[model samples]
Target: MTSLLLYFLLGIISAIIGALPLGAVNLAVIRATTTQTILNAFYIILTAGVGEILLATLALYYNIELSHFFTQHPWVQGSFIFTFFFIGIYLLFIKNKINTKNYPKLHTSKLITGFSLATLNPPVAIYWILAISWIDKYIFELTPHTSFVSLLLFFFGIYLGKTTTLYCYGLWGHKIAQQKNSKTKLSRILGVALIILSIFQGIKFIAE
Candidate 1:
C-alpha cells in the first residue's frame, strides 16, 4: 500500500511538472477549445494521454538502457531543441491564412490531431526517459514486478494530470475566446513561451 501510494504520488508529481510548461500540446488543446467544442478538446487530450502512456511504458521497460544511450548521444537533445525552436518561429512569424470565419469547419479531427502532434514531438519521449531515470534514482526499487506496477500507476497519473491540465486550459480558452481579439494575443503568448522554453532546454542540455 505504501509503495502504491509512493508510486502514485511520483506519477502525479512528474506528470504535473511535465505538463505545466506551455508547449505545443497545451496550446493545441487551448486552440481546439477556443475554436471548437470542449468535448472535442477533451478527445484530443485523451488521445494525447494515450500516447504518453505508451511512451511511459516503454521508458520504464528500458529505463537503464535508454538513460545510458541518452548520456552517450547528447545530440538527441538537439531534436527537442530544434522542434521547439521551429514551432516558436512558425507561431511567432507566420500569419494565419485560414479564415477564422469558417473555424467550425476548419479544424481537424481531435483524435488524429492529438495523436499526430504527440507522436511528432520528440520532447515527450525525452521526458519519459528522464522521468524513468529519476524514478530509478530517487524512488522505489524497480524490480520487474515493481517496475510494472509502479509504471502502471505512473502512467495513470500522467493521464489524469494531462487531462486535468488540458481541461483547465480548455475552459480558460473557451472563456477567453469571448473577449475581443483574444486569439491573437493567446497565440503570441504561446509563441513566446515556446521560444523561451527552447532556450531554457538548450542551456540545460549544454550544462548537462
Candidate 2:
C-alpha cells in the first residue's frame, strides 16, 4: 500500500516536469480555439502525457541510453526542429486547406495530435531522458522495481498539468473572442513565435 502511494507521487512529479512548456500541442490548441477548444486541448494534452509515460517506462526497463543517442546523433534534434518549422510554415500559409467547416467535431482525434507533439518533438525526448535519469537515481536508491511505476505517476501528473494549462488558455481565448480583436493577428503572432523558436532550436542543435 505504501509502495502504491509512492508510485502515485512519482507520477505526479514527472507529469509536472513533462507538461510545463508551450510546445506544438499548445500551439495546436491555440489555433483550434472555439467553444469546444478547451476540452479538445485537454484530451490532446492527456494523450501526450501517455506517450511520455510509455517512453519513460521503456527506457527504464530496457536500459535504453536515450541521452547518448541524442548527443551522438544530434541530427535527430535537427529533424524535430525541421518538423516544427514545417508545421509553422504550413499553419501560416496553407491553413485554409484544412476546411475547418468540414472538420470533425469529435474529440477522439485530439489524442493523436497530443501523442505526435509529445512523442515526436526533440525537446520532449530530451526532457524524458533528463527526467528519467533523475527518477532512476532516486528510485534505484529505494527499489528498482518501483521506478517505472513512479514514471507512470509522473505521466499522469504531466497530463493533469498540461490539461489545466490548456483549459486556462481556452478560457482566455473565449474571453478574447468576445472582443472585436482579430484572430488573424493572433495566428500570425503564434506563427512568428513558432518560427523563431524552431530556428533557435535548430541553431542550437547544429552548434552542439
Candidate 3:
C-alpha cells in the first residue's frame, strides 16, 4: 500500500539523480536532438530508459549476489577502470569520432545506439549496483524478500524518471542546436565534458 508507493517514489528520485549526470546515454540523447528530429531523440530516450530500468531491475533482484560477486573478484573493478580510461582517451584524443556527418545512416536508427550506449557504459552499471546497495543500507532496505509488486512499481518509476530526464536533456540540446547550429563544436564540448567526468569517476573507483 503506502509502503509500496514509497518504493516507487524512491525509484523516481534515484533515477532522476542517476540520469541527470553526463553519461554516454545522455550524450546520445543530445546528439540525436541536435542532428535529428525531436521524435528521433524520443526514440533514443525510450530505448535508453528501457536499458536503464532493465539494469535497475537486475540490481534490485540480485543485490546480494552481485555484491558477493564484486567482493569475490576485485579484478573486475579494474575492468571498470579500463573502460572509463578508454572512453575518456577516445573522446579526448581521437578526432571527432562521433561526427554524425561521417555516418549519417547511423543517426537514422537511434534505437540500437541508444540501448547500446545505455547498457554498455560500465560507470552506469556500477552506479546501479552501488546505488542499490547504498539505498538498501542507508535509504531503504531493498532485498529479494521485498514484495514483487513493490519492485514492479519501482521499475515503473525508474522508467518514467529516466525518460523524463533524458527528454529534458534533449530539449537543452535542441536549444543549443537552434542557437549555434554547430553540431561538431557542441559534440566536442560535450565529449570533453564526458571525458573529464569519466576520468574523475575512474580515479574515484581506483581510490576506493
Candidate 4:
C-alpha cells in the first residue's frame, strides 16, 4: 500500500538517526582492541541490533510518559547517575587497574556491557521515545490494520542500520587502537565527559 511505503521511508530515517552516534559500546570495543575482525564484529553487532530492535519495539508499545517516568524517578535517575560517575572515575582515575599492559579479550561479559550501555543510557531511550512516538503517531496512526506490521518492519530496518554503523565503527576503532600507543589520554577525556554529562543530567532530574 502507499501508506506502507511512507512508513518504510520514515523507518529508514529513524534507523539513520539511531545509528549516527558511536556510543559507549563501540567506544569500549574501540578502546579494548585493535584488530580487524569484521566477522566477529558483525557477530557482536548482531547482538546490538537485537537489543536496539527490542528497545524500539518496547518504546512504540509504551511512549513518552514511560520514558519520562524512568528519567524522572529519583531512585532510577540517581542510580544511573551514580553508576556513570563511578564508571567515569574508574576509567579516568584508575586506568592502571584495567591491566592495559595487554589487550583485553572480548567475551560474554562484554556483551552484557553492550546491552546495559544501550538500555541504561537516557539519551538512547529519549531518542527512541521520539522516533517511535513520531512513527506511531504520524505514520501508523491511520493504518490500524497495518500497525503491527509497520512497527516490525521499522524495527528491523533500524536494527540493521544501527548494527551496520557499529560494525563500521568497530573497523575504524580497531585500526585506531592499533596505532595509538596512549590510551590514558583518550580514557581521561571520555571519563571526564561522562562525569560532566551525568552530573548535568542528575541535577536536571532533581530539579524536575
Q: If scored against the real structure, what TM-score would every candidate get? A: 0.83, 0.70, 0.82, 0.72
The candidate with the higher TM-score, 1 or 4, is: 1
Model 1, range 1-208, lDDT digits (tens) per residue? 7887787777777777777887777888988877777888888898887776776777777777867877888777688787888887776767354456855655578898877776566567778787777677776664356756765776688888777777888898888888888777667767788899999989988887
- The lDDT for every candidate, in the order shown, is 0.76, 0.64, 0.78, 0.66
Best by lDDT: 3
lDDT of 2 by residue, 82-137 (tens): 87788777766666356787767665577798787767776876776666677667
Error of 4 at 122 (Å): 5.2
Which should have the higher lDDT, number 1 or number 3? Answer: 3
lDDT of 3: 0.78
Cα error, residue 27 of model 1, in Å, equals: 1.7
The root-mean-square deviation over C-alpha atoms between each candidate and the true structure, in angstroms, is 3.0, 4.4, 3.0, 3.9
**Which portions of model 2 show Cα errors greater than 4 Å?**
1-14, 89-108, 135-144, 147-152
TM-score of 4: 0.72
Candidate 4's displacement at residue 200, Å, is 4.6
Residue 137 accuracy (lDDT) in model 3: 91
Looking at candidate 2, what is the lDDT of residue 68? 73
Clashing pairs in 1: none
Candidate 1: misplaced stretches above 4 Å?
68-76, 96-107, 147-150
Which 10 successive residues of model 3 have the least lDDT summed? Answer: 99-108
TM-score between model 1 and native: 0.83
Error of 3 at 37 (Å): 0.9
Give candidate 4 regions above 4 Å deviation. Answer: 19-22, 32-40, 64-72, 96-117, 120-123, 138-145, 203-207
